[model samples]
Target: MTQTEKYIWLLNTIHRSRGRGLSLKEISDKWRDYMAKEKPLDRATFNRWKAAIELQFKVDIKCNKSGGYRYYIANPEDIEDDKVSKWLLDSVSMGTTLMGNLDIKDRILLEQIPSGLVHLAPIVAAMKSNHRLQITYRGFGSYFSSTFPISPLCVKLYKNRWYVVGQCFYREKWQEMIYGLDRIEEARVLDETFKYPEDFNAENFFEGTLGVSLYEKVKIETIRIRVEYPHAHYVKTLPIHPSQKLIVDENGEYAEFDITVRPTEEFFMEMLRGGALIEVLSPDYVVEQMKGWVNDLYNVYNRK
Candidate 1:
C-alpha cells in the first residue's frame, strides 16, 4: 500500500477501535498485515505518521500512559460533530468502499447533484475571507437574470442542493437572502470585505424552520401529525424532525407525533409526501391550510 493508504488505514483502525484504544504493538501488527509486508512500523515512523494524521485530519491521536500506552482519538466528539470533518470521513469511507468493489459499480445507485458543486470552491473562499461577492443570478421561472452584490456569510447543504445565505445589497436596505448556488450564473469575489454579523450563527438561523427556507417573521408552533400503520413505524425509526416526539400509540396500529417547528411550505410538503399514511392533526390554521391544499389538488384533477 502507498503512504496515503497506510495513513487512512491507521485512521480507520483508531476510529473503529475508539474507546478500546490500540496499543503500539497491536497497531504495528495490523499495519504489517494490512500492507501484506514483513516490515513493521518502528516507533519513530509511527510517531511521524501519527503527527501527520493529526495535522491533516485534525483528529488528535493521544496515548494513555496509564492504560499500557494505548492510543485513541482525544476528541472524538469534535470529529463526529464537525460538518467538514464528518463530510471528509464520509467521502473517504465511501471512496475506499467503492475501491474495494469496483466490479459492482453498475449495481449501486447514486444521487446526482450537478449545480451546487461547480462554484463551491469560490463561494467557500469568499466566506472564509469575509469578502463580498458580485453574483449574477436568475431564480427559477424568471426570464431575466440580475447581477447584485452580496456579503457571503455561510454555505448550507439541504436536500442535495447547496445554498448561500448572506446579506444582499440590491434592495434599498440590506436584507438577508438565500441564493441557490445552481442559480448563480457567475460569482466574483470583490476585494472589499465585510464583517460577518457577530451574533449570526448559520445553524441557529434555521433552527425553527424545516429545510433551508426560513420564514423569519413566521411564528413557530407545535405541529401534531397522526400517522397510520407501517408509515408510523418508518417515522418512528427516522424522525421527521429533531424535535419529533411520540405523543400517542407508539407501537400500535396508529401513532401521533408532535414536532415544534415553523409551518413552512417544505414542512407541509413533507407531510403531503406521506400521502394517505399521514394527517395533520392540530393548530386549526395549519389543518385548514392543509385541507385547502388538498381541495386544490382535487379541483385540479377533477376539472372538466
Candidate 2:
C-alpha cells in the first residue's frame, strides 16, 4: 500500500479501537490483513507513523502504560468537535469503505455538488494571511459578472454548497456580503491586507440565520410551527434547526416545535418545501408571509 493509504488505514484502525486500546501486535495483525501482506511494523516504524498521524491529522494517539502499552485516540472529543477534522475523517473513512466495495458501484448513489473546491484553498490562504481577495463573481440572476476586492473573513458550507462571507468595499463603505464559491469565476489573493474585526465571530454571525443569506437589519425571533402525521416524526428525529425544541406532542398525528432564528428567505423556502406537512402556528408576520408565498404560487398556477 502507498504511504498515504497506510496512514489512513492506521488512523481508521486506531480510531475504531478507541476505548479498547490496541497493542502493537494487534495493530500489525490488522495492518497485515488490510494490506493482504505480512509486513510487521517495528517499534521505530510504529512510533514514526504514530507521530506523523498526530502531526498531520491532529489526532492524538496515546499509549496506556498500565494496560500493556495499548494505543488509542487520546482526544476523540477534539476530533468530534472540530468540523474540518471530523469531515476529513468521515471522508477518508467513507472513501476507504467504498474502495473495498468497488464491485457494487452501481448500488451506491451520490449527489454531485458544484465544484467550489477550486476557490476554497485560495480563500483559506487569504484568510490565514489576512489578505484581501479579488474575486470575479456572477449571481444566478445576473447577465454579467463583476470583480470586487473583499476582505476574506470565513467560509461556510450549507446544503452541499460552499460560501465565503467577508467585507466588500462597495458604495464607499464596507459591507458584509456572502458569495457562493460556485458563483465565483476567479479569485486572486491581493498583496494588500486588512485587519479582521476583533469582534467578528463567524460562528456567532451565522448563529441567528438559517442559511448563508443573512439580512443586515433582520430581527431574530422565536418561530413556532406544527407538523402533521409522519412528517412530524421525521422532524422530531432530525430537527429542522439547532435551536429546535419540542413544545407539544399531540400523540402522533401532529406536534408543535419551536426554534429561535431569523426567518430568512431560505428558512421560508424550507417551510414552503414542507408544503401540506407543516403549518406556521405563531408569529403572525411569518404566517402572513407564508400565506403571501402560497398566494403567489397559486397565482402562477391559476393563470389562465
Best prediction by lDDT: 2
Candidate 1, residues 62-120: lDDT per residue as tens digits?
Answer: 99999999999999998788877777676776666676677899998889885757778
Residue 96, model 2, lDDT: 73
Off by over 4 Å in 2: 1-9, 36-42, 56-58, 249-251
lDDT (Cα, tens digit) per residue for candidate 2, span 191-212: 9999999999998989878888
| C-alpha lDDT values of all predictions | 0.86, 0.87
Question: What TM-score number comes out for model 1?
Answer: 0.84
- lDDT of model 2 at residue 14? 85
The C-alpha TM-scores of every prediction are 0.84, 0.86
Which parts of model 1 are misplaced by more than 4 Å?
1-12, 24-46, 52-58, 64-69
Error of 1 at 179 (Å): 0.8
Worst 10 residues of 2 by lDDT: 1-10
